[model samples]
Target chain A: MNKTTNQDPVVVRNPTPSWRAILLCVLASMGSAAWAGTPLRVCYVDDRSGVAADTGIQSFNGFQIAVSEINDAGGINGQKVEVVSYDGKTDPQLTATFASRCAEDDGALAIVGGNPSAPAAAMIPVASEYEIPYLMLSAGTDNLTDMPAPFHFRVGPRNAQDAAAIAELIARQGFKRVALINNSLPFGTDSAHATEAALKTSGVPVVIQQTYDINATDLSPQIGRLRSANPDVIVVFPYAADGARVLRTLQQQGISLPRIVARSALLNTLRELAGDASDGVLVPNTVDMQRPDVKKFFDSYKTRFGEAQPTMYPVLGYDAAKMFLQAIADPAVQKALAADELADARVAIRDALIRNGNYQGLQGHAGATYQFGPDRHHGPPDQNWFVFVQVADKGKHLVAADLATFKPGS
Target chain B: MKSLNTARSMLAGPALILLVGALVPLLLTSGFHLRLVTIICIYTILCTGFNLLYGYAGQISMGQQGFFALGAYAFTLLMSAGNWSFWSALPAALLICAGVALLIGIPLLRLRSHYLAMATLCFGLVFAGIASRWIEFTGGTAGMMVPSVKFSGHIVSRTELYYAILLIMVLVLVMQNFIVSTHMGRALMSLRGDETAAQSLGVNVTAWKLRIFILSSVLAGLAGIASAVVNRQVNPSFSEFPILVSILTIAVVGGLGTRYGALLGACVVVIAPQGLAAFGESETIIYGVCLLLFLMFMPHGLSGLIPKLFGRIRRKAASPAPGVVKAGEIKP
Candidate 1:
């Protein structure tokens, strides 16, 4: 018997389908597992199935374009990016489940979603629980600010900050009498209340305050009611789509005031959807129109998305993704960060952003900043550097006035 | 003979289900999945309670989500306001829900199926409205957080919350079993099938309806509490009228008239999203399609499918025809 001593394959006629076969099988299994580990691993969950689903879809598309750019640039750390998007269905419970699933199973390092306040409120704890940063693209609630998490960061200004900026603008425009028209949503109600109160404190009295449903098409009655008040300035606090509709309604009603100031929330979909109606309407926004950074952003956005005009949400989505990238790319993070301590990289990124007063974002702005600490969960106080922009020449929205233009308590 | 054998197998179903469910978290090794399972368990408890009313009692109530939301909000308010321990706050939430159920049931139970459904649906919408508008009390639309429920001094993690939810669900199930096995269960079932007939047989239909309504509300409230703790946050949207939940109960998705159908139904509805999301936002399109398919083909839901499948397998295994297949064909 010419048996191989310890090899033991000598007795087997077929030799277990050859060693080459076994090696291939082992290698194949490992290769399959490694393949599972790749794919950009991005997540998009939004209230995309509910009343605001259409706008949510637009916001998600913007984030998709950002991810597309990353992949086109050879992806992060040499791995390709794959986005796993789900609908929160405008439901909070569903959003929480989706957020947790991404963090725990999909190994998603960051998230972008929660167009509505209700869903974002539910997901705040999930972000903390999973120890992954969530960049809320549309949610404007300061609720997340109350309970600080190193992992939670938002690209836009907080509601209170927006309210303060709008108040400052009202003071600058020299509009003493303003009418606040808000939607029935939390954002509208709070913005209306905050803006009204802040303006009141700043010695500007709101002539009329009215609320309407965002889902309603005929804002004619609401507009008519507000028109009766006939204030010099009208501050509309409806969300993107509805806000756009309301702006068109006001224009149709021939109700353009001497000064039209809108919350940044209104500008979310205003420029494109509202068309010429959005022109000449002043908006207090974090977008810095003067900087080369802002110009680069518009050019990049236009090249990638084929639309030069960027919605507030897509701008936010792009900012958040890049911010996440910057956080994870720190040198100390590369040297000392372990798999378990990966969240610290996000923390480092947030800290760097807070310290950076001049973050050259995709948009042409260096003033967009972030601030975080154990006591302060809110973004930078200096993030209040909102510029008053006018929709110039129908197609372009340009900076009408910078923060330096507005004197304090003007 | 087949029915008898099937009954024997069903007697073993709960144990098998529990065994599998208990092992899922360990097997998955993903903290996210564990949290998802915890959510599934929370819904299982709630929909199970609704099952007792709609499936067994023949009542259609849309207000279960209201109870759920109320429980969560109540628990949040109580725990945060008083800095009360979670152990204390949970029972308080249940009692508050039960009390609200009693108050609302007095007027709501007076209405019949569709009217009852509408009324309960209104309650859910109203609760959402209050949560949105009444910012002072309910944290308004921004929502308020319920501090992480603590045990000793350590904050509970999502994994720990999952186990806590599982234990509560098991307890609710055990209690459900105890109730269903007794006279009250038979009486409630009779009322569901025919309140007039039950009344003719000397059953206090109204009283029984009120009792079941209140009991169901209490359980739903408990589920809400479990959900809030597990999710580590409370918002009005947690219970923004679970229309699908109500539909699942009476639709025979789980076996109609079978209490355990609630569990199967919840599993189907809840697990579908995680699996379907791979197809994208059109996952909702899938949900609608599945609803259509279930409505047309499997009217009795998973409950009907389960029994028929098991019976077929047992019949084939014990007495196989020439062309018949072997055992394990029927799933439990």
Candidate 2:
């Protein structure tokens, strides 16, 4: 006789399956299968770790939340929008891996993100190879915008364009002498160049230009040297962490100029982190806290996540998802677009976005919608939205018109 | 008798596990998942190379990343900028990497322990600085274009790259296994256990150490080239040491002497972080905690743990057969 064991599959007397269990299994199977008419998959890659993780992750989270909402609201053309998210960790190799996976396996209809330029630069050729629509969410390099790739689109201002807007504003203010402090990274270099061009156009003279590594701890020496220039205004270009260091040093050094301004790094958590130092500083920002669209977004953000407001990053991320889904909604596009012909959809969506110019985004809501053509893939128009704001007990408030309205060197 | 039974049991578990791994890829259809697996294999090759030197030889070389950066950069820069064919560029890259290993080894190998580690670490930092600063040649910090790797006429895609890496890793593993099992392998192990004693035994210690050092460096260089070819780009950032690579030497923490322990250790270090990344970025904290746990409980590592667990089982099973020679046992 065979000895009974626990490992043995003992036959148990049972009744027929319950209708509920049967229904649940059926539902689970259906859930696992990709719905036949699903909308195209698009991958949004960003730095999910490292120093960039602090801000870059917000971009991805915003995009994911928006994409989920879009699907819940009934997807693009009744087809669900899916995104295969991957962490770039601010590294180019990791970016390439995620991008390739999306192109090869996910059958991605498009790809979006380039919050940091180094990885984004690596991704450009891959997007070109797969011919998929690649949306640039925050890479403000003039190089990208100056010569547009066939399927590239930018949702934010290029450095030169943003600087030009500042130039226009600064020209009106009639300031004639300015000093520039910039980071060593490409972003800072380009911003300085653009600011120089704008300043030259506005007839504001640049007194001194200083450069420092983003990780530099001592800015007192640089500030001491720059203060010797004795310019009317000082323009600083660095990320939030670096900028805070610079601001604190400047404050401690006891040097005060007519105006202190910065590039985009002065936004978001950087602004919050700067605390009192953030007050009385003018930075280039498209998001007018007063705009109706932006106010709604801010309210929803605070209510949903219990924050005061979303920053330019989250706003851009939400817009990137909106822009991608809008493309998926086009009739010619679908889940089954061949990989080779993927760029066609990208071009189509890019063109649609460019023409749908002046449509409000979360930040630059009232700004002219993005318009694209054969020669241009940069979003909206080349104009400045840099409103000079004062940080106070209430919150950051616009105290002056766009920086473009002031004379450079002010 | 107990030791013989314990050894049999240890071999059986790993043998089963490896057999499962070898078969799983064949069953899976998703090219994406296969591509991920291929990446793991490439990293395994890299970690294995590090293990040989760090684990078996008791050397700490942080410049393995520098060699990797060199291989990828040299290959990509040659192919894209120089317009060389993939075949020609690959050999050129290998030769250059081996040449670097030779030049670096002469001075670097003379140092011992932390000094050697620090020296190698400095090399990696300097290499990264050069890659970023030498904008004219290395694409500065932005990175250089990696021309598509072509075999025959077809430009290799992700799918093809995965297979290529797989074939290369398998070949490398087999060669490594063969070397570690030979007389030379025993000599290295002897040196690791006691250098003075090993030399006393006429093992030609210096020559063996130099050979393994160069061999390990070449493997790292080749792995870098493979990664560059697969990813289609290389930048200065590639040289930054992942905390994982350091823990990868934990392969020795377990198999510190055995090749299998090195592999098992590498998988735990590499794959665990990746799986945990899904939970949050705090996965790093978890990795640190796990490493601490392993150090505290299983000092000899997963490799050492295996034999002990099996030995206990064999002790229970063979109580009745104390005087009986096991079928697998040979008279020593």
Candidate 3:
């Protein structure tokens, strides 16, 4: 009984399939294999599940819209464009990891979307290492273009450009003394430096430059100092959340003065957070919502995402995606891809994008035009992208303002 | 016979670890997974040092990430700006980190409990602020790129880096084992249990605590230098709040007092999140739930529960049936 229990069962191997069956299997597989050309894979790395998820989600939506539109109207060189997205969680390490995976595993033709400067900077070396074109969406740090990043391109307005625009506006208004308040992050410091340089060059005296913590809820001390300085204008460089806090604090302390903010301060969330306190604030926005092209894009974005109101981030995403798509659609790039030469195609696309001059984009609505050269990777180098707007109607509307229309001490 | 058994037990754990480490690369094909394993090894080094300080020495350090950032920045600055080779810069960075740790620990180790935590937290915040604000030196939060690690006239590949980190981890493990078996280790453990009583028993509490603190920070610095070499970049964000939270969480979940706890904790903290990354936004929620469950049921941690389980199994195996006569005992 032990032997019987321990004995293995007799092995029975089934005979191989007949030639007829094999033939049928092969034919069936052949019939089921639909011949759709190889997809043009692109990677979208962003903060999909962290504090910056709002911007990431909007950017994803905008990229999706662009992808769908391109696929609907024939894809690049008759190949469907597929997106492989990875959530970076706003972690620089994770973002770098995703960049490598996208380049190595996903075989992405290009990479896009690192909303914050940290992740954007992190993506630079990885993209350069992999020799893939990286289209940065929202990060506007000036250092991104300071070094020679051959394969990197930025679509958003840089801190230097916006500060220069504000300085020009200040100079045109003939403001004698200006007070600057900024957050203590890189964005704030860079903007402060730029504004200071521009103001110095324009012969306008900067009376005080104060900085607060990134997420400080109270700005009374900073506001009090600014009020004491008693400059003709106060320029603030902060994100929407902190900007709202600053605005509300200013209103609470009854320190009323001409205030101006960076593009990020124009967000609807700022208005909602600060409520009526956001009124009478001036913002330098890079996109004009009043333009017909921008309106059409907004309508389509709303239709797709079911969002009645869209923010500036999504438009930036749309422009970045559009620029990449335009590069891929170039005849030289298409020819390289057709030859199945991926590396060549990447190089060709980079060259084509660099050579692209005076290119009008969706952001052109705000007088923003993209021009890239071998030496210049950041788009719209000048202050042509900036438009000053006054927040009014309890922050429900933005009315365009011209510095030329106002007197110095009005 | 006792010496033989001791030798076997001592060799068994490391042999098993060596086997696993050897097999991991063969099993995992993706470069990303390999890189992640390297990261886990680096974190293991950091957590082990943290365990020595917090678990055995009874000091709470909330600013291990600050040391890590210091090491990374020091190494990068030396390599890039000073044009020093990685081989020389690495030791220099570690030494700088040790000196800084000594300066901080001398004053800081005097504080107890939450006050120490707050002090360390402030140090971390100040480190981050300096890294971001000192633009001329630290690149002002845009971060500085590190040169590729070169040794023997060849650039280190990802696999080679992974193995290098693994070798360092093994050496750390051996050192940790040696430390735990010594009288100093007993003194530290005693200090953790009852500080005043340990002092009455002739244990130099402050000296031991400060020494462990410095050692822990040096380990963090080493890990940081390794990280900079691997990533080829260093930034102010390296010392951010999330990294501190991760170190603390790894220490707590890995079984604070055990020798193998840091390794277990590092694996769970680093690899578990990557595994749950497929769930997208809910990854954080699921991770939180898992941590909560672990803390509720296995409060002492995964390493702490192992002995209890093994003892129960051994007792069952060793027990005799009822009414059976023993060789040396008379029946009742």
**Candidate number achieving the greatest lDDT relative to the actual structure:** 3
lDDT of each residue in A74-137, candidate 3, tens digit only = 7766776777677787788778877876765556788999878888888888888778899887
Please list the residue runs of candidate 3 whose C-alpha ends up more than 4 Å from where it truly belongs after superposition.
A1-38, A308-311, A331-345, A365-368, A396-399, A402-410, B1-11, B308-332
Predicted structure with the largest TM-score when compared to the true one: 3
* Candidate 2 overall lDDT versus native: 0.66
| Interface RMSD, every prediction, one decimal place | 13.0, 12.7, 15.0
- Tens digits of lDDT, candidate 3, B1-332: 97677555545665677677766666555565666678878888988899988888878889999999999999999989999987789899999999999999899988999999889888888999899888889987678888888888898888888888888887787677667767878998998899999999999988899889989999999998888877878887789876787787787688897888888787777667555655556778998999998889888787888898999999988888888877998987
Q: Distance from true position, residue A392, model 1, in Å?
A: 8.8
Query: In model 1, how large is the Cα lDDT of residue A346?
Result: 45
- Candidate 3: clashing pairs of residues: none
**Model 3, total clashes:** 0
TM-score of every model? 0.82, 0.78, 0.89
In order, what lDDT does every prediction score? 0.68, 0.66, 0.78
Residue-by-residue lDDT tens digits, candidate 2, A1-410: 11222221211111111112112333222222132343456777777675567557667656765776776677666656656666667766557656755665456667788777677766776776666677777766555554536666777666676677666655667667788888876567667778898888778889999988889989888999988988777788788788877777777887656455554544555666666665567666656677777677666556555564335667777787887776566655543243335556666665565555455566554654565556777774664344445444322443433345334433
- Per-model DockQ: 0.32, 0.21, 0.25
Second chain of candidate 3: TM-score?
0.93
